[model samples]
Target: MAAPATATILSDEEKAVFAELRNEHEKHRSVMIKMDRYYEGVQRLEHIGLAVPPELRRFETVVNLPRIAVDEVERRLDVKSLMLPDDQIANEDLRVGWEYNDLDAQAPQAHKEAMIFGRSFVTVGSNEEDPDQPLMTVESPRHMSVKIDNRRRQMTAALRQYIDPERKTDSATLYLPNTTIWLTRDNGSRWNVTDRDDHNIGRVPVVMFLNRQRTGSWFGTSEMHDVLPLTDAIARSLTNLQIAAETHSVPQKYVLGMTKGDFVDKNGDPIPVWESYFSGIWAHANKDAKVGQFSPSDLKNFHDTVNHYMALAAAITGLPVRYMGQQTVNPAAEGAIRADEARLVKNTERKQVSFGASWGWSMSLRERFRTGEFPRNGRIRLEWYDAGTPTMAQRSDSIQKLSGGTPILSREGAWDELGWSEARKARERQYFLAQESDPYFQRIQEKEELNDPSILRDPVQEPDHA
Candidate 1:
């Protein structure tokens, strides 16, 4: 009776739908695999916990480096207010945009939160009569956090290299800038805020290393008509000098202002005057007549223009410029001062070990290795030595106590009855009995003196009471 279901021969439309579904499924599966890998890594580390071996940890804080005067550093960098041709400026912007996009593609999770606003805004210099405007007026307020990819890994790598004890390196290395979002409203608003409810527009500091061991740099592009012409410019036109001091080998107490009030006074003034710094990366400023959608060619043209400007700037400065802000250090350490920071203190704890020459031993403790939590318990081994004049065979006579384990935790009631010390003594008694079957160690009396000198001569003697 139905119009004889017109021969449903797997229509092209249905095939297309099936194809789309397949693509989506593949994407989701890939994402799931990646997430699984990430979780597995986290689980592995979490099981290990934060309890690092004493041998691997540096409990001591070393020397502190003096903060560089912001004004002085800015003067040295010499930020220019140069304006480039319109076409060139547009190209630079698009190039930076592409790089940023590439960055996003690589780390979709983190880069999604990034803010790229300056590509549309322009900063001009003073003097309306002058034809050229400023590139960008950079205001350095003491310190700032700039964004970077894999920020934590980058910082840790730098710290590891800088503080390698084997190398005995003392000089502080400059860190790439940790960039924060800097925005302007319309054309004449403050270069800080972006939202109404969010009034703390200055800068949101990102916490990575507690110490000021990292630095940040930001890059952008502007048009020639929007900034100054630097060809005829002199060194003094925009230089602001400040002093940088280095202290001697002494650990000084330097406070990093974590709270806003620490850096801002009641009168709303900055506590320390930072050296202002300004610099630009290569960028292209395209002004195409057509106002429709931009084509891939348009983007490519902009990228090329930016590369050109970056090359020019790098040549003039004789330093790698454009979109890089790697922290630097002076190899000579001429201006550096030495100061001792902190020292490490060692603590001692008494742990028990069993002696079993040519015999097997086992020690066990309750342990739970969770996916995202610390381990419940752990165990270690000690080599029991031969009672005779120390020889390699005597050293090899020890049996690992952890080979077969013991429950670290016991019922509170059972613990109360046995007492922890009594329980430990019981384990020692069992361990001694295990060696009874082996004639070589059978005569090693339970109450006899051990080879280790640390063993007490008198059992009743109390160790340092503390």
Candidate 2:
């Protein structure tokens, strides 16, 4: 067969299509470059930790916490259940300090009514430092009432939920809440009313935990009664565990096993250790040790406790123990970011458009979009007056002004036309510019859309079908 004839000619449309494709490829390459740069910047900020200056430190830390915890906490709490109830009552009348109030005022009336119903409010407590040590006494409200029986009941219920059924420990037998707070009002003028204060405020248990071990285990320790020390010790131990988990180089399972049980070698053999030499990993402040009294005692104990755990895990796992860097933002970038941020903000003499609205407007030609509501046409709309449609003026003005009176350029519609330009090309560029100029603003729009674009649509009424 004769060799295929050489291709002769291409249509104008085909040429345009090829050119468009080329342009798209170039756009994609440019985007990838920018994204790579952005990712590198983020990685540098993350891995370098607080190497960034003061202002950015908080930004970095706040973002990192939840991202790191997401995989960890997902199983612990069903996130949906943690949401506060819709009708949850907030005691708005309560203030941190005493405020002079008129008897006729709504808040005073509410407070009086609550008092009549035996509802107590939280009061600002005094913080008095212990003269000799780095300790402070924090006093709770003197007028508050607590129900000990009710609290114990709730604690028992919670215990039952998590406890093993076969090995049920009697919650009461395990040393349940025993601590109580007795409160009395100090209304000097109303002696009779004040006299009944103690009666109105019932004693409530201060909850605490106990550490229990198996019967044969040499590690079984007696149940201590102090609530504060127990809490402190537990908190310290948890902190130590957190530090170890953070520093460990091996898999999470290995680190967890090291903490909960005994550390094992690579061969799955438990390291035999004598019980006598292994002291408890935590210590509490001794009341007898004053600040001036120096034997390098309690502080040393605390420091040693933290350091010992950290060092042990680090040595075992071969992970470096790194100190937290100073919290500070980059001085050089602060001024520039701030300036760009301010420019990104729009200052109006009249009503101010929010960043969200500005972003949506920037992304589309929908000038009639207000905020919330949906129309029957099935587009996420922002406006109520025009029902998400662009005004005629908007369409005309946009086409003329944006197209710059160029005869060769194609004009889709006047700017006011609702959803006039749904073309992917224009929107991509618009959103891309938005992302480059303000990552935060871009993130908000992306998040809103992700959650539900129609969420902002106004609720509509339906005609009765019957």
Q: lDDT tens digits, residues 107-223, model 1?
A: 221111111111111111112232121112111111112223455433211110122254333211111122111222233421222211111212221212111112442222111
Tens digits of lDDT, candidate 2, 122-237: 11111123211111111111112222234343322001011224434211101113211111212342101101111111221122111122333211112111211322333345
What would the TM-score be for candidate 1 when compared with the true structure? 0.13
Displacement of residue 73 (Cα, Å) in model 1 is 24
Summing lDDT over every window of 10 consecutive residues in candidate 2, give the lowest-scoring window: 190-199
All models: lDDT? 0.24, 0.26
Q: For each candidate, what TM-score against the reference? A: 0.13, 0.15
Off by over 4 Å in 2: 1-91, 94-196, 201-309, 313-320, 324-466
Clashes of 1: 55
Which regions of candidate 1 fall more than 4 Å away from where they truly are?
1-24, 27-41, 44-86, 91-466
